[model samples]
Target chain A: MNLEDYKGIWIFVEYTEDKISELTFELLGIGRRLADKLKVELSSVILGHNIKCDLNLLFHYGSDKIYKLDNKHLEVYRTIPFTDALEYLVNKYRPEVLILPATSIGKDLAPRLACRLETGLSADCTELDIGPDGNLIQKKPSYSENDYITILTPNHRPQMITIRSKIFTPQTPDPNRTGKIIEEHLELNESENWTKILEIIEEDQEDANIQEAEIIVSVGRGIKKPENLGLIKKLSSCINASIGASRSIVDLGWISHYHQVGLTGKTVKPKIYIACGISGAVHHIIGMKSSDFIIAINKDPEAPIFQVADIGIIGDLFEIIPILIDKLTIK
Target chain B: MKIIVCIKQVPETNNIDFNPSDLTINRSHVNGIINPFDLNAIEEAVRIKEKFDDVTISVISMGPPSFEKTLKEALTYGLDSAYLISDKLFAGSDTFSTAYILAESIKAIGDFDLILCGKHAIDGETGQVGSEIAENLKIPQATNVKKIEFHENKKIIKVESDTENGYRVLEVKLPALITVNKEINVPRIPSFKDARKALKIPIIKWDLGKLKNIDKTKIGLTGSPTKVVNIEKFQKKKDTKFISGTPNEIVNELYQILKDKHVV
Candidate 1:
């Protein structure tokens, strides 16, 4: 009933060791656009211990206000403490919209916060907009298949949106932009923290992180038998490209699902994506469509993949792949 | 120790095709299977049951009546009991409502020391329901669990879960919820004999009428605060050009295109 109390838009800034997460800037970029359209101020929340970062750093990213919860217990990324800090800020400020990343910490915290506040949180969203009736329109893959679904939370306060990484481009930092930073007060105690972080060890996740690679040479079922995959790998290595596979290739047991690139697999936005023996199914196309340059080498002239490729080559990959390995020898 | 692992039936994606007209998956042509991560959760619970002398593992799923088959399959994996929560009211429920009903059903099952789930359902992919259930039950939660250990006579549990950067080891008190990732363990396949014997046991079924003290406004699509407003089919770019030639000529052309794109 007190809808007027809820105003500005807020971004949950996930930071560590004085470096802000890239997703924060991206949210700020999109949040600024949304906030401007609604004629509301864009604010950010920072929770950390002994935090010494320059508050003005956020002003460059178009943030109009910053809410700080600084305490010794707020240093590391603990679930309870972080969630409590965020919950406290939202309940008091009553922001109309809140955005967070779909990272591990965000994934753990957002759902709990939404439940605690009795609001709705949309996860892994790729697009966000304010609807005509002022509701938040959340766009994301339903996670079942390749199609995008638009979701709206009309009744929840601080309508929450969790966005996946690399979904949006961040804006350039402007030195002239200025804003107000308001430090908040909070009562912190160790007893309230049930989960204890004894150690933090980063896992070596080099396998699927290839989605971040510059050049990727991916193979599909068109590569045929599992043994013939050697030709695809040889070409990838010749160009110093990462190896990727279509869902069918993985399903056929030719490669691990970790190398799968499709709606069910990882969404890759590489610089150069070479699809070898790929028929360009929609499932495979969505994953690599963002590539700056795509070249499809499928024997079928009518393969759907050529539609998205910059240059479509209709020929036998069995012969062309070896020549590709020899012609552009990166070594 | 009494543990509950929540799983779901997901449409096997490989055989399904995207309906270009409405941008929805054509599920009529595919079959459903246990969510991949949930199988990891079931295996972890089974491993725990094997380690302890007095442990009962129960598997729960919220789906249509056909999901009774999925619960039976869970029993073949060594779980002691199975529960299926199906209701006309639950047909269009979102994540929050789904978590609420599951939490209430877990409460009805009585005291439990552990609750486990897949980090995210393959279909919804929100990765939120498990934590939402924890919130509804007012318990601690650890997500993306890759490794877990019991300590202090099962008074507390320590776990190392995967994160975007790597992994973090955290210790939480018992009677908590955790969502496991795929790296936990390789799930065991259901044996034909175990599968057959498992189906002989009657599955516990509960509908909205059976669940007590639940707010009706929060159970189905009406209780769900979110709605899908639009579904648009993906349209590929049409400006691409085709090239056909001898292997040498095609390679030369591609090499030139890559150079022009500065794709090297």
Candidate 2:
């Protein structure tokens, strides 16, 4: 385990539908800072089939170089093929640090890659920094926002961590910046492959995609009956806000898991997050704490949601939602 | 057919208590529950067993001896056997070491046709164990699986795996691993008869001594590559404006605030 043999910092670029994921750019944003601190070049690793995009966009975001692993088999995200390609790349190049997004695909690939490489990986990290001792310091919530554990891979080469999205602001794209693109090829054996994609079904785009919503009208256990979701839908429609829910209601089958807003679900940061009847647990709070403004309406004054809310209203959601809806509709 | 379902015992509540002195979970006073997602895995395994002929399911967990209680609860769901891999040396294992230990333990348990686990545990929520186990065993994996079906030949399995916006139907060969999502199935509760029977059934215990050819440096805290260097209580200040009034007044205040921000 010669740590010195590992050099540059690498961010695995992820793509969907011919577009690079926004989370990849976010990693590049933080990756730039860490690379500069460690005095190493930052690179982007992209694997796919016939990826038709301007590679300069990555350099614009901040990458000194791009490694392209283009193969027909690499087109789809199967765990083994993707992991095998990355394992080969990491072994050949020996990057000092590797960062990935904590998305569904990233979560699946990262652990498998780390295991094959025999390295360390931190998951869903909220923060990354270079320590005084020159180790990459990864900070993640230990079950709650109030408690955080700082992790480091002191002896491991190519330290790894999966970061959540929207945590950092991507740098403005610089047209003047350009980098070299390196094309790498590896032999992928079909016999070693164990999974085959039979079909893909993309759900219709619904107005309830709250991750990108500007305003969110979220409900919780306080909404009581499943029928009460109508009231929330009315408020959301009135304000043109997307609907979100705490895990409790989703667990109760009051709504689809798509609307769930919490740790196990999607993390959202809308401009206005109106939480109704939500006694926010720490798990739920970590997902939405970054919202620009939070308004919590709960009967219990001591609800944990109120602690983080900019505006705390004490009342029954059933009573208040109708009035609020009526008031907003009149104008 | 043989199946191995992996489970973890997590704090029953989200308000996890931490030891003030060491920043470790203060497990002394906390009640544990089978991780909610693992229950889904158990249910999925049970459904598979019910659908197949001569299928046997065994549940395994790597934790303190107290975890045997949770494993016993799994048996009430009609699992064939339970294995507990516990040792003082396994304490403070990160996901890497934890997965290594489980893979070795699984090897000791002999061969299986399939492996199942929860998407992730709530306590740590790393979600790395299942994938890492597959990697160690050199098998393929599908995560966030919503539905699964064995082929007529019973050698290839097809599943509906969840993605961000949609789902994909994938066909995985036998001897694969999968981590199931909560949407997979509704877990059943143990009946009184099964509960009583489970209490009498003995759970197999395995320690380092039971696992042959085990590497000493790859099973515990010292073997873990990633180290927790520091832990601190997070603090954030918010100047909350508590609104007090009638429903109409509250609505008026909120409307004004939203209007100022052009939210309406």
Candidate 3:
């Protein structure tokens, strides 16, 4: 397992219903950095049915070589056939590092590939870097809601890591850039696999994915009464923002589980995130730490949320939100 | 049918504190329990076992020997058998290495129809190990499964998976891996019968030697492809500006500040 024997960094480009997940491109953004750090070629392993049109997008996202696995078996992302194709390619090329987006399919596929290869894989990594010794150092929040743990697999081969979505900014696609495309052929029959995707029923699209929202007004425990949420909602509506909440508010049943934001909750990187009376815990921080601008409105000045906020208002949210709404209407 | 549910002992996050000097967590004050998601998986296994009276559920985990506390906790939940994979040599494994060891251990146990795991470990959230185990063993896997049903005659499994937008139905065969979500089922508290039996049963403990053909290179830090090159504790900046006024006055002042900041 000499590091030198591994030559390229590979991204598992995932797609569903013929559309690529945004997480795939986000991984490319981060993968480009790792590729640059290691001074190796950055490539992508695209497995899907009729993905000829998708190959160009891989190069635009910094892949030097696109290893395309096109077959009907890969059409719906079944585990057995998809893993077999990926394992075949890995054994042939022997990539030094493999990166996958922590999407549902990627999460399921990456670890299985690592097992077959008898290598190591790091899951849901928030941060990744190369050590001086050339080991891929992965930093993830550990202890099931505690502080961050830095893990290094000094002895592993073809280091594997799955990164969460929105943690890395996607690099702008450069249409002018060009790369080599190498298509791999699968040797297995589709009928032999044990799993088959019978149907894919699409859900109604919600407008409230926190990562895409420009403005977010989040409620915490400090709102006092659950009825007080109307005031916060009115304020959010006035600003054309979505409403979010810390885990405490959700646990208290003030809001639905979908509104909760934290490590176990949804990770939001909104441009403007307003915290109402939420005492910032590390679990909550990991979810919203990437926000472009953070505003904390808590009566306690010493609350941890204030530490990460660009603007700190040491006042009760109940008293402040209505006034803020009124003032916005004036303009 | 036999099912294996893998669980991990994790520090309860609600009470964790950071020691500033070393950037490590202060675990002394924290309580440990089975990871919440893993608990959901264990509960699902129990439900499936109950449906098929002949089924047996085995709970397995890989951590420090002290993590046996979590296996006992699983017993209280009605798991029929328990095993702990612990060795000083297995330290510092990334998800890849973790899956490698777990897959090897599963192989040693033999003849399991289904494997269950949490969608992602709360601490790492990498969600890579379960799928990796399926890959290592070359089995089918469905993740973020909210609902799972087995069709006995056809040997097909109907799984409802959580997608970015909604749910999708997938059909996989037995000897597969399924990672469940918290929405699947409410885990039951252990009955007195199971609780007492759990206390009486001894959990099987294994070291690296029990696994067959384990390439040491792929079992620990050596087999891992990733490493943490460096760590810098997140530093929080102090805010100097504090607005103090009567409640009404403070509201007005906040209004003005919001206007100035264009946050309204």
Candidate 3 per-residue lDDT over residues B160-221, each given as its tens digit? 99876677898888788899988898788889998998898789999977764677876565
Local lDDT at A176 for model 2:
94
Write the residue-wise lDDT of candidate 2 on A48-98 in tens digits: 999986788899999999999999998888888888899999999999999
lDDT of 1 by residue, B1-264 (tens): 999999999877655555544445667877888888899999999899888889998899998999988787778987888999999889888888899999999998899999999988766778889999998998899999989999959978999977766789999898899999877888988778767778677899998778876788888888886777787654545577887789988878877776777654
lDDT of 2: 0.88
Model 2 interface CAPRI class: medium
TM-score for each model: 0.92, 0.96, 0.89
Share of reference contacts kept by candidate 1: 0.77
Fnat, 2 decimals, each candidate: 0.77, 0.80, 0.63
Give the C-alpha miss distance for residue A141 in model 3, angstroms: 4.5
Candidate 3 residues lying further than 4 Å off, grouped into runs, are A16-20, A36-39, A52-57, A127-157, A191-193, A224-227, A251-256, B17-25, B152-154, B208-217, B221-231, B236-241, B256-264
Q: State each model's TM-score restricted to chain B.
A: 0.93, 0.92, 0.93
Worst lDDT run of 10 residues, candidate 3 chain B, spans B231-240
- A best-first ranking of the candidates according to their lDDT comes to 2, 1, 3
Report the C-alpha lDDT of model 2 over B1-264, residue by residue, as the tens digit: 899999999887655543433334456667889999999999999899888899999999999999989999999998889999998989989999989999999998898989999999987899999999999998889999999898999988999989888999999998989999988999998778877877877999998888866788876788999999898876354677999899889889999999988987
